[model samples]
Target: MAEINVTPFVDVMLVLLIIFMVTAPLLASGVPVDLPDSRANPIDQQPDQVTISIDPTGTIFIGNERVETGGLPDALAAIDRGQAGNEPVIVLRGDRTLQYARVMAVMGELNRAGFSSISLVTNSSQSAP
Candidate 1:
């Protein structure tokens, strides 16, 4: 009686496992910042959605593009005008050290620029191990 060899199957599976292992870390999120913890749930399901990040240094970023405080309104307006809808959905990621007033001011600017679908980006406190 002759037995069929399964070495090829084992080799393919091992290769796939190695590939996944190598790419898994790359799939993780960007650099870790001191994200403001919250009890509120995040609404975004798509990873490619628009995001505006405010660093602790008061630097403003629109979809990863660094913009001056004066340019924020125009930057947001550009994003809004380029979108399919007038009211673009934006995720605001502010540092924990960011002042409440500054954050509110950003939100106000977004509202005045015609963005009604703004969502605050926060990681659930309960999610941390």
Candidate 2:
């Protein structure tokens, strides 16, 4: 009776597991921010949606490009022009350590730019015992 070889299969599985573990975090969108925990339901991600991230220091980013608060509206307008008539969803990713006002300021800009579909991104809250 011949025994089946399991060592190579186990090695391949281990390598794949490690690869996924390393890339999972990298798959998250926009700048790295410590998102606040919330009980809100997750929203469906849109392909044409725009991500604006606010880091701990209150720096704003459109995707990976840093943009000044003053320039945000114009930047958004440019994006609007590129997308033509379709209204792009705006997702705000703010650091948990940031003051509420800072986040609101960014939101204010988005509102002034006439972006009605805005969403705040947050980490899911863990269930209590």
Candidate 3:
């Protein structure tokens, strides 16, 4: 009778698991932001969150995909239309160099598009309470 060796495979899996566990936190670094300090408390977040990023150049991104301003409303409308049951939280990440008016404009657009549960993304390292 021939038996397959399972011990070595299990050992390799264990080693990989350890490696991943050590680096997992580093991997979750969300879109970088030089967020202005706020006195408000941070909100607890779930896994079902969507991110929209605005770079220093004022370029908009939806999960790494460049989105034109003209198409932003339509894209958000699509998201709202596609919801089956649960509503996903939308998070906005804007560069600190961006003008406040521009950021507010985007937020207003999001609201107009019917995205109610929106959150602003921030760098946890720099954010205070």
Which candidate leads the pack in TM-score?
Answer: 2
Candidate 2 lDDT by residue in tens digits, 3-121: 99999999999999999999987876658899988988999988888999999999999988899757887887877534556788998999999999999999998998888889999
Clashing pairs in 3: none
Question: lDDT at 96 for candidate 2?
Answer: 93
Higher lDDT: candidate 1 or 3?
Answer: 3
The collision pairs in model 1 are none
**Candidate 3: segments with Cα more than 4 A from true spot:** 1-33, 37-40, 80-85, 124-129
lDDT of 1 by residue, 6-37 (tens): 99999999999999999885555343346777
In order of lDDT, best first, we have 2, 3, 1
For candidate 2, the TM-score is 0.78
**Which should have the higher TM-score, number 2 or number 3?**
2
Ranked by TM-score, the better of candidates 1 and 2 is 2
Model 2 worst lDDT run, 10 consecutive residues: 76-85
Clashes of each: 0, 0, 0
lDDT of 3: 0.78
Is candidate 2 or 3 superior in lDDT?
A: 2
